[model samples]
Target: MEEAADGDWVVRPITGAATGKTYRCPGCDQEIRPGTPHVVAWPAYVRDSDLDPWDVDSAADRRRHWHTACWRSRDRRR
Candidate 1:
């Protein structure tokens, strides 16, 4: 867990098998195929004050998938 200017982030390194879902990598704007290891992350804050636990589903929507290389150097893609 770490806090930055953007927001609090819970960084998790995970194996692709665990995901059981395909996602698009925001860092590279490419498909993150299932069974391919990647990163899954979520913000550590609550967006709505009245919401419970900050709305995990909403956070998941906001969370981004990233290729390992893209995460290491996203600026290169830009």
Candidate 2:
């Protein structure tokens, strides 16, 4: 893991949820190139539940960004 300026160890995305899309850096408002090294906040891992179960096919773990410029490069479909 590479050490970020904010003292976070940035690691490569190991899951398919972050595979193809472009993400923006919350710190710099620059494009986070696909497959590039980035500092991602890993979410809490919860067991599958009936009320709020995880969808294996859905990109559920995709985290939100701190800035709009950090959004995916593709225009979102409503």
Candidate 3:
């Protein structure tokens, strides 16, 4: 797992061999075909500030799959 440059997210690489299903990339609105390498990212949770016990679950629910290139250049895109 890798921390995003902005420190707001945790990103993990998905190997082509491990990808079993297609996913829609939020960055480009394109499909991430099965067997295509990609990244899965989720929002970083801050346990100290939040009181909600479901924050962890919420973060998991927000996880997204992104094309590696799209994820890399996400901040630069408008």
Candidate 4:
């Protein structure tokens, strides 16, 4: 987990699980293939001077799975 410009990013790499369920990448609106290696990212707990921690955490809960490329390109879009 690390502090990110947008939010605290907690990123994890997943592999070798044949979970048949598919996840949609919010970055690209495409289905993440079953058992495919990818990134699962979320916001880390943050202590802000001017913001509520719970609000930041709740928004982090909305974190979505993303293709490696898509996630890496996140900053470029902005």
Candidate 2 local lDDT, 1-78, one digit each (tens): 433333322233434345477766655666766655444542233224412644543323544332322322213421
Clash counts per candidate, in order, are: 0, 0, 0, 0
Clashing pairs in 3: none
Better of 2 and 4 by TM-score: 4
The TM-score obtained by model 2 is 0.32
Q: Which stretches of candidate 1 lie over 4 Å from their true place?
A: 48-61, 74-78
For candidate 1, the 10 contiguous residues with the lowest summed lDDT are 49-58
Task: Write the candidate numbers in order of decreasing TM-score.
Answer: 3, 4, 1, 2
Could you tell me which residue pairs clash in candidate 2? Answer: none
Indicate the residue-level lDDT of 37 in model 4: 77
- Off-target runs (Cα >4 Å) in candidate 4 are 16-18, 46-60
Name the lDDT of candidate 4.
0.74
Kindly state the number of residue pairs that clash in model 3.
0
TM per prediction: 0.63, 0.32, 0.76, 0.70
lDDT of each: 0.72, 0.42, 0.82, 0.74
Best of the candidates, TM-score: 3
Superior candidate under TM-score, 1 versus 3: 3
